[model samples]
Structures are given as structure tokens and as C-alpha cells.
Target chain A: MSTVIDARDLTKEYKSTLALDAANFQIESGRIVGLIGPNGAGKTTALKAILGLTDFEGELSVLGMDPRHHRDRLMREVCFIADVAVLPRWMRVSEAIDFVEAVHPRFNRARCEHFLARTKLTPSQKVKQMSKGMIVQLHLALVMAIDARLLVLDEPTLGLDILYRKQFYQTLLEDYFDENKTIIVTTHQVEEIEHILTDLMFIRDGQIVLNTNMDDMGERFVELMTSAEHADAARALGPLDERHVFGKCVFLFDGVSREQLEPLGELRRPSVSDLFVATMKGTYE
Target chain B: MKTFSWLIKREFWEHRGSFFWAPVITACVMLALNLMGIITGEVFLRGHPSVMVDGTHLDMIGHYLTAEQLRQVGAGLDMSMLSVTGVLSTIMAIVVFFYCLGALYDDRRDRSILFWKSLPISDRDTVLSKVISATVLVPVITIVVGILAGLSMLVMVAITATFHGANLWTMLWTAPHPFQMIAHLLAMIPLIFLWALPTIGWLLLCSAAARSKPFLWALAVPVGAGIIVSWFSLMGVFNLSSTWFWQHIVARMLLSVFPGGWMAYDPSIFQHTESPMALYDSLSLGHMYASLVQPEFWVGAIAGIAMITLAIFMRGHRDDS
Candidate 1:
């Protein structure tokens, strides 16, 4: 598969703070990549660098073009939803749709209107009067209307309700996804998006600590729960991550087959959230 | 060209609600006030009087008396309401300025730069739209409102002047040269941009710089900086002369965007000692035009371009939200 986004030794510094440090990553085209990281883990910085939003060291490219040099062209195919709340507070829902229609040559007004109808939003209603959930729904509708090849969403569901959130990705998957389309989403709610993600990237402190495909993740990182004693034994088999819950210990092991890994403890499927928690705990070193 | 038209139209659609209604309300209030003044006999300055006959401005008493007997105007009005129309025009200009600033800050604050950046348009187009909105559109709207306002003034003046027995035909047809008034307005445009360019630049930068509350910082920080610097400059605590101040302001405002020489007039001209237009005319300031073509002006010009470039660069990459 061709790479849609590629970053090599990317570094970003703000005043005295190093926001990103030699971060290296790439996303294949026609795949949904979940970028899971905590706040200040440089997920935003990395995304911005890819978008050419800040001056940074190292090289980055999206769709084979540097964001700094080909921002307009890259942006034509690569759209982003930064924050839904600030989606032009003064604009009416229809006006916002009209704006997208005005700017994006590939924006489908009919699609936007249909999506708005699904959300039960009146086109003439001003966005300021809408609830936070409605704002996300509106933003999602507008973004999904664009025929962009790549969509980057940063904390897209930050304040959205569970119903809207489910409806959003569901709509995104149903209407927006195609063979040429790719989506990179960064959210802490890993499990909610895990099913839609073809690839999962675990970032920590501005570095991609783990980059694994969903199928590979499911195979390689077998979550084995055991007594506290077997946890140390499980760590011996190349532990990728581990965490404690009550008095029980769970471990994620690398290069250990499920059949053989089962001997160490009680093997269970690791959810993306469990993996994220284990990664954060630094137990799966 | 279609994209540019779309940009202008989008601005109109988004802002037209506020832009249109605000002026219409002001216009209604102005027309009402003028109609009130026309009914009463108080439509003139304390020493000077005027009024409108049909569409024509007439100053003679016979014409105003002829017109007065025919109409009651509004609210049992009198001449004292003439100033209301003048106030309306000034209010309109102020409102337009604020509106332009708000429009400039809107995309940045909304992070809708993402939306625009994704389009087939350039940063130049994006930045130029704002410059046009502020320097051209806002001012053009203000001028139109001013003309409407000027009409109101002329009507009131003609009414009172005619009431006081002045010549009506001369007031409308033989009035002072309209061309000269137009020329004065044309001259004011560059000067207005020169004075406010820094503020404009600041707004554009802040829009890209902040994720939230962009305008407050965009407006406040610069005015704050200008005040602080001017205070120090006044107290002899800073060595930068007014000439240097103008140069810096010009550098920051117009940097790299266009001919830096745009603001390269002689320092003495800005002094209220003489009106800028009179100074421009008397000095045959072809020298001022010559100054703009210089390398120094180019350097300042480069700065303006660089600031815009920096803003685009920041806007393309940064994720404030």
C-alpha cells in the first residue's frame, strides 16, 4: 500500500519546550489509523506538523507532497476537523454548509443536507443556539460531505454524546469511506474507535512507542490475567505492556503465540482500552 | 476568479446578516431623524441652514417654504434632528471598522482556516480578502453610508437654508464641487490604511496565533504595545524617533506584502500642522513616490510579506483547538 502520510525524525520545539522529539511515523493510504495518546503526548504536534501548521525540524509529507510547500493542494484532498465547538458560532447551520460548499470543490451539498436531516437539525438554526452534541453532528456532517482523500480528526468527539459519537463514526464509515479515503483520528476513547481503525499507533511522550496493525495487535498482544505472582513470570516472555486491576495482574506479551502464551496465565483478548491503559502504566516495557 | 467571487459571496452570506441589518437600522433611524428635522424649522446649523427639494438640495427660503407646505415629514419633527443623521454616519463608519476587524478575525478564530486552506485558493487570496474587507469593502460600505448620510445632511441644510430665505437653486446645483469632495475621500483611503495597517496585521496574526479569543488578543496586544512604546518614546526612555516609529509600524504592517514605499511619505506630512492632502499637493511630493522605489522601502515591504508568510505558515500547521 502507498503511504499517505510519512514523517521522518520530526522534531518540534516551542520556546524552551520540546513538543515533539524525533517522532517517526507513516500511515498507509486507504486505511483508518487510530493515533492513541494522552494529552501532551505530542499527538497534536505531530498532526500539526503533518498539516504544515508549525515550523519543525525533519521531513514530513502527506500524499507525496510537503505540507509547507503544497498546503493548498494537499488541503484540497486532506481535510481536518480540529474542534467542533468553534465551528463558526455565528453561522447558521445552512450557512456553514454553504461555506463548505463554496470552498470545497468536492463538497456534496446534498450529502450535507441529508446528514443534517438525519441529525434532525433545521438548516436555518444558528449554531450558537445548538447544543454541543448538535455542533459535533453538524461538524461531522460538513466534514463527511467533503470528498477529501484524507480526513484528520483531533479529539473529534471531545464533548459529544455517546449517541452522536456512535452516529458520527457510523456515518463516516458508511458514507465517507472509500478505497481512496483514509482517516487519522486521535482520541483517548480507544475502544470506541478501535473497531473502525485498521491500524493502531500508540504514542507516548511525543514518540510512537508502538505501531501495530489491528490484526497483528489482536494476535501479538494477548492479555493474560494472573495472580500477582505469575505477573512477574509473564514479564519474562518479552512483556510489551502490563497493568494491575484490584489484586489481579494483566500482561501484554510480544512474540508469544496465544497457545503458548496461555501457559503463562489465563489468556484473554485485549481491548484497545486495556492496551492503552497498560501502555500508560509502563508495565508493558 | 470563481473562487474569489465565492470568497466575496461567502463573506457576504455569513456577514451580510449583521452587515446589512446594522446599516439598514441606522439608515432608518437617520431618515427618521432627518424627516423630523425637515418638519420643524430647526434643520440648519446655528449660523447656516439647508434643505432638500425633491432629490435636489435647495437653500433658498422660497424653495423650503414651497416644499414645507407640501409635507408634514415625521413625528411632528423640526430642524434640531439634523445632527442625528451626521451622528448616524459616524456611527456607521465605526461599526464598519469593527465589522471589518471581526470579519478578519472570524476564520482564524473559528479554525475555519482549515476549511479555506483546503480550497484551491492561496494564502494571498485569503489574506487579500481580509485586506479588501477592511481597506476596501468596509470603507466602501462606510462611504456609501456616508453618502446616504451626506444626503440627509444636505436635505436638512437645504430645508433650513431655504427657510431662512437663502437661494435654493444655488444650494443644490451650484453647490461646491462634488469632484473635490470625491478627491478628498479618495485621498483619505491610503491615509486610513496607513494608520490602521498595523492593527490589520495584528488581527490577521492573532487569528492564526490563538485558538480562542483571537480578537481580544489581536486588538488589545497591539494597542497595548503601541501605547507602551509611545509612552516610553514620549518620556525619552526609548531612542526610536517618530520617523523610526513610522518605519517600524510600516515595516510591521506592510512587510513583504507589497511595495513598502506605500507608506514612504515624508514624516512631516503626518503632522496635523497641515492636512496630508494639502502637503501632498504643495510639495510636488513626487519625491515621496520616488522614496517608495528605494531599497529601504523594499526591505520594509519584505517585512510585510514575511509577516503574511509567517501567518500562513503558522496557520497551515498549528492546532490550537
Candidate 2:
């Protein structure tokens, strides 16, 4: 697979504060990658750097084009929806759509109109009068209307309700999926996106603590719970980390196989959220 | 170029409420004022004074004036009323300035800048639209509205003057010089731009810096700064208001010219213009439109360009969210 995004020693500093440490990452062309991080973990900063919204120390490229040097060209192919409810206040829904249509060479007005219809927004409703969720939907409609190669959504569902959030991801999946397109989404709702993500990357303190595919992740990582008597033996299994929840000792193991772990109290597939919690709890060398 | 027009169209649409409402309201108010002046006869019959009693309070208070002097007084009143329309021009500037502030700030607050930046347009187009809006488009609209108001004022004054036996043909034919009016207007281009550039630039910068309620601080800070500057500048100068206006105009002209200090020109290009009261005598007939020919004007314009360039770079690099 070709690398759609490549970052080497990416570092961003604001005054005396370090916003992003020396971070290195690569994303292939066709995969839907989930960027999972806690609040203030530099997820937005990284995305902003990628969008050329700010200057950073390290070299980074999207589609083999340096965003710093060729931001306008790079932006033409890469669409971003940041804080999805921030559509301009004075713009009518139609005028905003027309603005996008006017400026973007690849913007498809028919597609944008169709998406607007699906969202139940009228062409003339002023953005300031719309509800917050409706604004996000409008923003999504605009972003999705563009024929972009890469879509970077930062907290796209931040203020949205469950239904709107579901619709958001559903529309993204149905309308935007293709071999030549890539979507990188960062959100706090990991469980909701676990099914859609082809690959998952967990970043903590500006470092990628976990990088693995969903299929291999299940085979390589297991969640094992043992009775108090067998907890010590379960701890001996080369687990990534263990935690006590609701009076039971649950452990996450990476090196041990299912056949070799049958002696533990219980073995089951760990949900991405559980794995995220386990990974976040421990010290990784 | 097509996209630039499209952008301007969007600006018009966004400001339709203000643009439509403000001028209409202003025209209505001005029409009413003109009508009031006509009916009262104070506007077109000024020198006539309704009576010629000057020796004593009540002795000739009821006495009337000669027909010829009354007509001359009417002519003078008509001219003064026509001059009153100049107030409408200033009103137009205020309304247009309000709209420009909203336009400049709205782009960043609503994430419209992101939408535009994502497209193929350069920052130069984005910034130039503001200059065009303030300098070209709004002024054109203002002038159109001003002409309409002036016509209305002229008609009312002529009818009222004729009622008092003044010659309507003379009032109409030998009216103020349209060329001189246009000349003063041409002179106002740099003055208007110079007076408003920093405010616009500051608003643009603040818009880029703000995430929410973009206009609040974006507007308040610059106005607050202007008030403070005006206050301090007013304190030191003897005839402080004139000096303050001159210095302010010069500074704005400087920003407009050098945007990023591409030239080191003095702001005196604008400073040398006569005050509005003295303009009739102090200004040469040709000098009203002569501002465009100055090297200092170009230098100030370059400074303005440089400032806008710096503002765009700052906005592009700054983290708003």
C-alpha cells in the first residue's frame, strides 16, 4: 500500500509548552484509521499541523505533497471538518453551499444539495438560527460534497447526539468509502467507531503506544479474567496490563495464545474500549 | 476573477439585511427632514427670516420683507439645505463601516475562512475583497444613495424657494459644481480607506484569533484602542480634534500603502488636505482629486499591504480551535 500520509519526527511547540512531541506516523492510502487519544493528548494539534494550520518542526507530507509549501493544492484534495458546528453565522444554508461550490473545483453541488435534503435543512435557513446538530450536519454535507482523496475529521461528533452521531458515521461510510480515498477520524466514542476502523492507533503523550489492525488485534491481544485464587497465575501470562473492576481481576494479554490461556478463569474477545483502557493503564517499554 | 465576483456576491447576500434596511431607513429619515424643512420654510427661506423687524422686538415683528430680498434669502436657504445633504454622505460612511466590520469578522468566526482557504483562492484575493468592499463597492452604493438623497433635497428646496418667488431655473442650473462634488469624492477614497484600514485589519486579525463570538472582541479591541488613541491624542494638541483626525487618517493611509512596510513613507500625504470647513478656500480646485498622484500615498498604501500580508500569515499559522 502506498503511504498517503507520512510524518517524520513531527514536533510542535508553543512558547515554553510542548504541544506535540517528536511523533512519527504513516497512514496508507485506502484505510479508515481511528486516532484515539485522551483530551489534550495533541490529537487536534497533529491534525492542524497536517492541515498546515500551524507550523511544526518535523517533515510531513500528505499525498507526497508538503502541506506547508503546497497548502492550497493539498487542501484541494484533502477535506477537513473541524469542530463540525462552526459554519459561518451569517451564511444561509444555500449561500454557504454556493460558496463552497464557487471556490472548490471539485465540489459537487448536486451531491451537496442531496445531502442537505437528507439532513432536513432548507436552503434559506440562516446558520445562526439552526440547532447545533443541524450545523454539524450542514458542515458534514459541505465536506462530503467535495471529491477529496483524504478526509480528516477532528472531533466531528463532539456535540452531536447519539442519533446524529450514528447518522454522521453512517453517511460517511456509505457516501465516502472507496479504494482511492482515506478517512482519518479522531473521536472519544471509540466503541461506536470500532466496527468501521480498519486500523486503530492509540496515541498517548505524543507517542503511538499501540498500532495494529482490528483482525490481528483480536488474534494477538486477549482479555482474560481469573478468580482471586488464580489471579496470580493469570498475572504470570505476559499480560500487557491488569486491572480490578467490580471485584474481578481482568487482564489484557498480548504474547499468549488462546490455547495456551485456557487455564485462566475466563477468556473472551476484548472490546476496543476495554483494550484502550488496559493500554492506557500500564507502562509500555 | 469569477470566484472573486462570487465571493463579493456572497458578501452582498450576507449583508442584505443591513444593506437594504440601513439605506432605506436613512433615505426615509432624510426625506422627512427635507419635507419638514420645506414646510417650515426655515430651510429654503433662511435670510428672509419671516420678517424684517430689526429696530425693536415687537415694533416690526409683524412687518414683512421686500420681494427681492426675500427671493435672495430663499436662494441662500436653498443652497444651505442642499449642503445639508452632505450629512447623508457621512451617514452612509457609518452604515458602510458597520457592514464592513461584520463582513471581515464573520469569515473567521463562522469558519468560513477555513472553507475559503480550502479552495484554490489565494490570501491576496481574500484580503483584497475587504479593500474592494470598503473602498470600491460600499462607496459606490453610498454614492448612489447620496445622489438619490441629494436629488430629493434639491427638488424640495426648489419648490419651497419658488413658493417665496425665487427663480427655480437659477436654483437648478447654477447649482453646486458636480465636478467639484465628484472631486471631493475622489479625494475621500484614500481618506475613507486610511481612516478604516487598521480597524479592518485589526478586525481581520481578531477574527482569525477568535473561536466564538468573533465580532465581540474583534470589534471591541480596535474601537477601544481607537477611543484610547483619540483620547490621548486629543489631550495634547491645542486644536486636538483636527490634528487627531489628520494623524489617524495618516496612520490608516500608511497601513493601506505599506501593508507590511514595503515602503517607508510619511503619513503627511493625507495630513495636508484642508479641513472640511476650510476646504472651499484652502483647497485648490484640482487638489481635491490630487491625492492619488502622491508618492507618499503609494508608500502608505504599500504599508497597508504589508500589514495585511502579516495578518494573513498570522491567521494561517495561528490555532483558532
Candidate 3:
């Protein structure tokens, strides 16, 4: 796979804190990479740097161009929905489409209209009149209409209901994602996006703690649910995290073989959220 | 070029109320007032015929006045129409002043700056678009509306004069020097816009730089400096009155945007010469255009460009939101 984004020792410092600290990662084309971290963990900062919205100290390239010097040129191939409700409230739906169509060379007005036709949004509706779900749908329609190489979403479905959130990802997966495109997303709702993400990068304290593909996650990390009698034996295998559920001890282990874990208890693959929690807790670095 | 055009269109979209609607409303109100004044003047004239001495008003020095005096009276009426337009333009200037002060700052306050930045347009284009909207587009729109208002009022006055048994075309229209008046008004727009550049540039810079309360920030520094200069001068510390910062500031605020002090010149010429034609003749497009080569104009233009460049740089680098 070709790499779409490459960062080496990327760092951004604020007056009182270092938002991103020597962070290094790569996003290959055609992969939906989830950048998971708690609030203030520098997730937004990293995305801002990638989008050329902020300056940073390091070498970074998107689509083989340095974002700092060529931000406007770079924006032609990159699109982003920075957050929910970023659309101007006074702009009518039609004006938004016209504006994007006029300014963005790759934007397809017909495609955008087609996307909007699927929802209750009409040309006359202003952004302020739309509900949160409608706004997200509008934003998604505009984003998907752009023939961009990379789409970065930072909390795109924030403050929406579960129904809209589910529909948001569903529409993205169904209509937008393809082999030639790459998506990098960061959100607090990790589980909702876990199923669609091909790879995950866990960041904590401005550092990437874990970087691995979803397929490899099963082999590299295992969750063993064993009775209290065998919990000590499971613990001996260096489980990355331990918790109790219904009088049974659940231990998450990394890099321990399934055969070794099976003897201690029932083995299963840990969910991305559990893995994220374990990773953030510094149990496995 | 296309991106810049779209950016400019976006500014018009956002500021349609100030750039388009305010001047339209001003025109309509001025037209209404002119109509009311014409009716009242006609009633008062007919009811008081004795006030007309020797077939002309006693105040007009009887009927011994020559055609030159009659033409001057007609010109005086035309000057009133121009005054109406002047008032409208003042309103437009005020609208544009606050518009420039808030143009950059409002987007950041409302968090819509993100939407604008997400486009493929550069910061330089965005800043330039706002500047053009303030200096060029707004003034042009106001001028168009002012001209329309002035002409409509003149037509109304001519119709009212006809009802009063007076010759409409030669007396009302010809006396005003309509072509010269229009040419002078048209020339004033670019001159005033250039003269006001320093204020416009400073407002935009403050809009870009201030996190909150941009109005206060834009005003405080200049006002504070003026106060310091005055305090030092009063205390016999130095003779800095030659700097004329305070004089220029007041002029920019009141007089610079006007053409050749016409607002002040109008009433005085009308009082002394008692001929609106004399006032019309005094309104010189040549004098207004002559200021284009003045040192103050060049200094303000260069300073305005520098401030605007600083605003662009601030917009690009200061992404606190």
C-alpha cells in the first residue's frame, strides 16, 4: 500500500503545554485509520497539523507535499469536516452548494445534489433551521461530493443522536470510502467507528502508544475470561489489563499465544475500546 | 481569479444588509422627505402671495433681478438635492466603517472562519476580498444608490415646480449643472476611499488581531496615543503639535470622506452668493482629484497596504480558535 500521510517527530507546543510531542505515524491509502485518545491528548492538534490549520515542529507530508508551504494547493486534494455545526448558520443550503462548487475545482454539484436528495434537506433551508442530524447529513453530502484523495474528520458526528451517528458512519462506509481514498478520523465514540476502522493508533500524553492493524490486533492481543481459581495463572502470563465481571476475572494479554491463554481460561479477542483502555492505562507500551 | 471572485461574492452575501439594503433604505427615506418638503413649500407659497414682491418674493429683492439671479435660485434648489445625497453617503460611510471593523473579527467570533479556511482559497485572497468589499464595492453601491436618490428628488422637485406654474426643465434641471454635479460626485468616491484607507486598514488589522472586543482594541490605542501627545504638549515637554495626529484623526472621522468640504461649503455659499448655481460651480472635481498626488494620500496608501499585509499574516498564523 502507498503511504498517504507520513509524519516524523511531529511536535506542537502551546504556551503552557506541549500538544503533540515527537509523534510519528503513517497512514496508507485505502485504510480507515482511527486516531483514538482522550480529551487533550493532542488528537485535535495532530489533525490540525495534518490539515495545515496550525504550524508544528517536524517534517510532515500529505500526498507528498509539505502542508505548510502549499496549504491552498494541498486543500484541493484534501477535504475535512472539522467539527459538527461548522457550517455558517446564515448560509442557505443552495448557497453552500454553489460556494463549494465555485471554489472547489473537484467538487461535483450534481453529486452533491444527489446526496442531498436522499435526505429531507431542501435548497431553501438555512443551516440554522436544520437539526443536528440534518446538518451532519449536509456536511457529509458536501464532503462526499469532493473528489479528494484524503478526507480528515475530527468529531464530525459530534452532538448528534445515536441514530444520526450510526447513519453517518453507515453512509460514509457505503458511499464515500473506496480503494483510492484514505480517511483519518478522531472521536470520543471509539466503539461506533471501531468496526469500520482498518487500523488504530492510540495516543496518550502526546505520544503514540500503539499502532497496529485490526487483523493483527486479534493475534497480538487476547482477552481471557477465567474463574477466580485460574485467575492467578492467567495473571502469570503478563496480561496487559485485569478486570472482574460476574465473579470471573477478565485479563487482557498482549502477544501471548492463544494456546497458552486457553489453558488459563476462555479466550477471545479484545474489543478496540478495551484495547484502547488498556493501552491508555500504560499496561502495554 | 475564480477563487477570488467567489471570495468577494461570499463577502457580499454575508454583508448584504450593510452594503445593499442600508443605502436603499436611506434613499427611500430621503425621497419621502423631499416629497413632503415640496408639498409644504407649495402650500406656503400660494397662501402667502403678498410675500411675493413685484411678481417675485420680497425676500428676492423684487422683480428687478436678472435671469442670472433666477438661474442661481434654481441652482440653489439643485444643491439641496445634492445635500440629500451627501447625507445618504455619510450613512454609507458609517455603515462601511463598522463593517470593516467587524469584517474579519466576526467570522472568528462566530467560528465560521473554519469554514472559510477549509476552502482552497489562500489567506491573502480572503483578506484582499474583504478589503475590496469595504473600499470598492460598498462605496460603488452607495454611489449608485445616492445618484438614484438625488435624481429622483430632482425629478420630484421639477414636477412640484410645474404644479406651481414655474418652468421645470430650464429652471430646475439646467441650473443644477447636472453633468458637472454627477462628475464631481463620481470623482469623490475613489478620492474619499483612498483618503480613508488608513482607518480602513487599521480597523481590519485590529479585527484580525483582537481576540475579543475588537472595537475597543481598534479605538483605544489611537485615543490613548492622542491623549499622551496632548498631555506631553501641555506639560511643556515638547512641541509635538506639528505632528497633527489629532487634527488628521478628526478630519478622517468627519471631513476626509467628504468632497472639498462641500458639506460646510454648501450653506455658506448659499448664504453669501444666495445662488445654488454658484455652489454648484464651486463643487470642483479637479480640486478633489488633485489630492491624489498629495503626500498624505501616498503615505496613507502605503501604510494601509502594510497594515492589510499584517492582517493577512495574522490571519494565517494566529489560529487561536
Candidate 4:
């Protein structure tokens, strides 16, 4: 697969604080990569650098073009929903569509209109008149209609209810995602998007802690649940994180084979959320 | 070109109130007042019972006046149309000033800048769109509205003249040089736009750079400079009078509408001409064009371009989020 985003030793500094510190990663096309990080973990900074919204020290390229220099040119194929409520509140739905159609060559107005037809959004409706869920739906409808190769969504569903959040991802997956497109998303609610993410990158303190495919996660990491008697044997294998559940020890091991772990205790694949917690905790430790 | 057009359209969309609606409302109010004034004047004349002249009462003034005296009255009426145009111009200037000051700052404050920046449009295009909207589009809209308001006022006066048995064409339209007056007013707008560049550019720069209170920021810097210049003058360093700063900078802000001092319009036109048409004729477009090569014009243009370029840079580099 061809790489859509390649960042080598990317560094961004805001005065004394290093927001992105030699961060290195490559995102190939046709993968839904979740950039998971806590607040101030440089997730937004990294995304900004990639989107050419900010300058950075190392080399970064999106779709074979240097984003810093060819930002306008690069934007032709890259669509982004930076955050919730980014659309101007005073803008009417029709004006918004007209604006995107005029400026973006890849935008399909008919497709956007088709998507909006399914929602409660009308052409005359202003953004401020819509609820948070409706706003997200409108934004999503606009974004999904663009035939962009890369779609970077930074906390796209940041402030929506569970129903809307579920609907957002469901609609995106059903209507927007295809094998030819690449999506990079960041959100606080990791569990909500974990099922759809083909790959995940865990970042902390401007550094990547974990970068692996979702399918490979089970082979590389294991959560072993065992009685107190077998807990010491499970711990000998150097689990990355340990916790107690219902009077039993549940140890999360990274890179330990399941065959070896199964003999000592019940081995199960760790959920993405659990893996993320383990990864972050390991970094702190 | 398409992107630039859309960018400009977006600007109008965002600032429709200040750019379009405010001037339209002003024109409507001015028209309404003109109609009210004409009706009140007619009612007062009828109630007071002026002497009859040719089947209509014109005894208070028109019947007794000589042809020359009537012409002078006509001139006065014509000059009032110019005054209306001036009032509309003043209103437009004020609207544009505040619009320039807030254009860049408002989007960033509301976090709408993120959405704008996400588009394929460059920062240069974005800043230029705001500049053109302020300098070109706003003035054009104001000019159109001003013309309509002027016409409405003249029509009301013409109707009043007919009621008084005075010749409508001679008393109102012909004396005012209605077409010439409008042409002159329309011609002045482009010049005013060029002349007001420095102020517009400074406001835009402040709008882009200020994190909060753009008004205070735009005001404080110039006032601070004036204060320091005054202190230096007190020390007898170079004999720099405060009026020099006021004339060169503060006065230049209003110079677009009121061209005086070095680039002054001929005061003789007001003194000599009884006809507003003659007043417009005496005013030389050549002098206005000559002022283009003057040091003040070039200095202001260069400074304006520098500030605008800096604004573009700030918009590109600053991450407001």
C-alpha cells in the first residue's frame, strides 16, 4: 500500500514547550488509523502539522507533497473536520454548500445534497439553528461528499450524545468509507471508534507509544486472567500492566505468546481501550 | 478565480449587516425624512396662506422672487442633494471602519477561522478577500444606495414643486446637475477607497494580530505614538508639532471624504458658484489624479501594502486554536 502521510522526525515547539518531539509515523492509504492521545498529548498539533495549519521542524508529506509549502495544492485531495462546531454558526446550509462547491474541485454537491436529504437539515437552515447532532450530521454530509483521498477528523464527534456519536460513526462507515480512502481520527472516546479502526497509534508526551494493526494486536499483546496461585507465574512473563478483577489477577502482557500465557491462565485478546491504557501506563512507568 | 470569488462571497455573507443592510437602512431613513420634510413644508405654506400665483399659492417667496433669486434658491436645493450624498458617504465610511477592524478578529474569536482555514483557499486569498470587500465592494454598494436615496429626495422635491406651480425640471433636477452630481460622487468613491488604504490596512492588521480587544489595540498604538511624539516636541528635539501627526495620520483617515489642506478641493467653487452644477464643474478631476503621485499618497499606499502583507503572514502563522 502507498503511504498517504509520512512524517519523519516531526517537531513543533511553542516557545519552551515541545508539542511534537521528533514524532515519526507513516499512514498508508486504505486504513482507518486512530490517533489516540490525551489532551495536550500533541494530537491536535500533529494533525495541524499534517494539515498545513501550523509549521513544524522535521519533514512531513501528505499525498507525496510537502504540506507546509504546498498547502493549497495538498488540500485538493485532503478533507478534514477539525473539530465539532467549526462551521460558522451564521452560515446557511445552502450557502455552505455553494461555498464548498465553488472552492473545492473534488466536492460533489449532488452527493452532499443527497446525504442531507436523509437528515433533518434543509437548505435554508442555518448552523446555529441546528442541534449539536444535526450540526455534526451536516458537517459529515459535506465531508463525505468530497472525493478526497485522506480524511483527517480530529475529535469529530467531541461533544455529541451517545446516540449521535453512534450514528456519526455508523453513517461514516456506511456512506463515506471505502478501500480507496484513508481516514485518521482522534477522539477521547476510544471504545466508540475502536471497532471501525483498522489501525491505531497511541501517542503520549509527543511520542508514539504504540503503532500496530488491530488484527496484530491480539498476537502482540495478551490479557491473562488467573487465580492468585497462578498470578505469580503470569507476572514472571513481564506483563506491561496488572490489575485485579473479582479476587483474580488480570495481567496484560505485551509480546508474550498466547500458548505460553494460556498454560498459566486464561488468555484473551485485550480490547483497544485496555491496550491503550496499558500502553499509556507503561509509558508513565 | 473561482476560489477568490467564493472567498469574497463568504465575506459578504459573514458581514452582510455592516456591508449591505446598514447602508440600505440609512438610505431608506434619509428618503423617509426627505419626504416628511417636503410634506411638512407644503402643509405649513398652505396653512399660512401665501399669495396666489398661477392657480397655486406661492406668495411667501416664489411669486415675489426675481429669476436670479429663484436660481439661487434652486442652487441651495441642489446643494442639499450633495449634502445627502456626503451624509451617506460618511455613514459608509463609519461602517467600513468597524468592518475592517472586526473582519479578521471575529472569525478567530468565534473559532470559525478553523473552518475557513481548512478550505483550499490560501491565507493570502483570505486576507485579500477581506481587503477588497472593505475597499471595493462596500463602497460600490454604498454608492448605489446613495444614488437611490438622492433620486428619491429629488422626486419628492419635484412633486412639492409641482404642487406649488413651480417648474419641476428647472427647480429641482436641472439645477442640481443630478446626473453630473451623481457622476462626480461615483467618481470620488474609487479615489476615496484608494486614499483610505492606510487606515483600512492598519485595522485589518490589528484584526488579524490582536487576540482580544482589537478596537483598543488599533487605537492604543497610534495614540501611544502621538503621546511620545508630544513629549519629544516638549524637549525641543526637532520641533515636531502634534498637529503634524494629526494632519498626516489622523486627518488622512477622513481625507478620503474631505480632501483638504495639501490635496484640498478648490474652496473657490463653493464661494463663486450659485449652481450646484457649476460647483461640480469647477472641481477638477485632474487635481485628484495629480494627488496620486504626491508623497502622502505613495507613502500611505506603501504602508498600507506592508501592513496588509503582514496581516497575511500573521493569518498564516498564528494558530488561534
Pick by DockQ: 1 or 3, better one: 3
Across A71-141, the per-residue lDDT of candidate 2 in tens digits comes to 87788899988776567777888888878888889999999988888777898899889987898889888
Candidate 4, A1-285: lDDT as tens digits? 899999999999998898998999999999999999877889999999999989999999899998888888888899889888888999999999999999999999999999999998988999999998898898899889899999999999988999899999999899889989999999989999999999999999998878999989868888989999998888788989999999999999888887788888788888988888877764444
Per-residue lDDT tens digits of candidate 3, residues B129-157?
98888777887887778877877776775
How many clashes would you count in candidate 2? 23
Model 1 residue runs over 4 Å out of place are: A225-250, A263-266, A283-285, B13-23, B42-89, B96-121, B152-321
**lDDT (0-100) at residue A266 of candidate 2?**
89
**Once model 1 is optimally superposed onto the true structure by TM-score, how far is the C-alpha of residue A142 displaced, in angstroms?**
1.4
The estimated TM-scores of all candidates read 0.74, 0.79, 0.92, 0.92
Off by over 4 Å in 3: A282-285, B50-67, B70-74, B170-176, B234-239, B249-280
TM-score between candidate 1 and the true structure: 0.74
Error of 3 at A200 (Å): 0.6
RMSD of each: 7.6, 7.0, 3.7, 3.5
* Cα lDDT for residue A142, candidate 3: 93
True contacts kept of 4: 0.76
**How do the residues B1-321 of candidate 2 rate in per-residue lDDT, one tens digit apiece?**
888988677667766655555666777787887577455655455666442211111112124445644444344433343353355455555655455445545666556566666666666676667656756666566555655665566566555545555444463556444334545544555555654455455555544455566557754654566677676775455665744554454345323322212112334334534643333333333443344465545554465556566666665665664
| Per-residue lDDT of candidate 4, residues B150-254 (tens digit) | 777767766666666665566554554667667866777667766777888888899999989999988888777767777666425556677677667765543
The 10 consecutive residues of candidate 2 chain B with the worst lDDT sum are B52-61
State the lDDT of candidate 1 residue by residue for B252-314, as single tens digits: 442312212244344533444354334334322343444444444455435544655666555
Q: Is the docking of candidate 2 incorrect, acceptable, medium or high quality?
A: acceptable
Candidate 1, CAPRI quality class derived from DockQ: acceptable
